[model samples]
Target: MQLVVGRIGRPHGLRGDVSVEVRTDEPEKRFVAGAAVATDPASAGPLLIESLRWHSGTLLVRFEGVNDRNRAEELRGTMLVIDSADIPPSEDPDEFHDHQLIGLAVLTPDGERVGEVSDVLHQGQDLLVVRRGKTDVYVPFVKALVPIVDLDKGILVVDGPAGLLDPDAIV
Candidate 1:
């Protein structure tokens, strides 16, 4: 399984260096010299990292064969992905990979089934995308909202606020 690690941003300079919008926490391990990562569109590349450096807190990478600014610009917005098998397990118990959360059943504190986790969005806040019927509900993945993650039981308990799970219900 391919997991997205980062997205190629704008070209940095006259050379084929592009800034990266990193999605993974282990950027140092994932983005390094001579690392080859797969691309999203499939046509862009299995880009080989010729070199990488941090420029003012931003990760800048130059891929092999991409020697000019135009070549780097062409790779803009390309998602850099690695095999899921390549990811090392987190030592922290609280840390859960997106793959680990994806198929887990979501339930209320009372054990009423709400949905199944379809995705986890990592924006400014982490949001769990729970699929209920044909629709998807975005639930904030915080301790107050999601108190329990019973991975062994394949379920997670949601301690949602009023009208959070059901909009039609009176607040």
Candidate 2:
């Protein structure tokens, strides 16, 4: 099970260091030196983390053999990934992997079908993007609203306020 950790933003310095837009919650564990991460195109890597640093909220990393800015420039837009073995599972049982949450059926507490979860968008918090009929619904992935997740049954129970799942009300 591979997970996306970050994406190369731009070449940072004359050295091989490049800026990255981090997508993972635990960067210290994921972006450590000596760790090897695979790339998207499957040609840019598997990149070895030669060094790691933080500038503001962004991550800066240098890879072995990519010792020049020009070399790093070629890696812009590259995605960094790690295996499931490298990451720890969520402590909360109800919590889930993005892959697991995606595609689950969204329903009310009484089993009223709302839609299917198309995606899980995360910024500071997670939001479930649901495809309902001809429209899309964005539901906050909070414990209060999304109190139940029966993955085995392929269902997500939403108890949000009125108009949250209504396309006409939301849009």
Candidate 3:
């Protein structure tokens, strides 16, 4: 399993360096020199971190064998992924990665089945998009609405107003 660590933003300077929008919590540990990371499948193989530095609050990185502006440009829009095992385990009981929530069944507080989480979106606020039948419903991933997220049981208990889980209420 691989976890996305960052996204290739754009070519930084002319020396084959690219600006990366860090996505992981531990950027310094995962984006160091000689660190093994994989970019988009378009690239030949996993990227070898040649060098890394912080610039203007973002990460400036150079991958091995990519030594020109053209090479850096080729990596734009690529997502950097690292082995999931490389990331340190989270100690927080309630905290979870978005990946873990995907595909989990959503249940209402009244023990009614609502839908399954299709994806977790972050647009200023966290949102859980659930798929029920052919329609998709968007629910705020707040403590008030989502009271319990049991990964072991593969269930997410929602506590929203009646009809909020209905497909017609989503539009």
The lDDT leader among the candidates is 1
- Local distance difference test, per candidate? 0.89, 0.87, 0.84
Better of 1 and 3 by TM-score: 1
Kindly list the per-residue Cα lDDT of model 2 for residues 1-171, writing each as its tens digit.
677879998998899899999877677877889988899878899999899888886788999999999999999999888776755668989778776777799999888998999878787788889999988888989999999998899998999888889988943
Candidate 2: regions farther than 4 A off: 84-88, 133-135
User: Which candidate number maximizes TM-score?
Assistant: 2
Runs off by more than 4 Å, candidate 3: 25-29, 53-58, 166-171
Consecutive 10-residue window with the lowest summed lDDT within model 1: 162-171
Q: How well does candidate 2 match the true structure, expressed as C-alpha RMSD?
A: 2.1
All candidates: TM-score: 0.81, 0.88, 0.78
Candidate 1: list runs displaced more than 4 Å. Answer: 133-136, 167-171
lDDT of 1 by residue, 36-147 (tens): 8899978999999999999898999999999999999999999998888877878988888887899999998899998899998888888999898887788988988998
Which 10 successive residues of model 3 have the least lDDT summed? 36-45
lDDT of 3 by residue, 64-162 (tens): 998999989988889988766655656998777777888999998877887899987776787899999998888999989999998989999989887
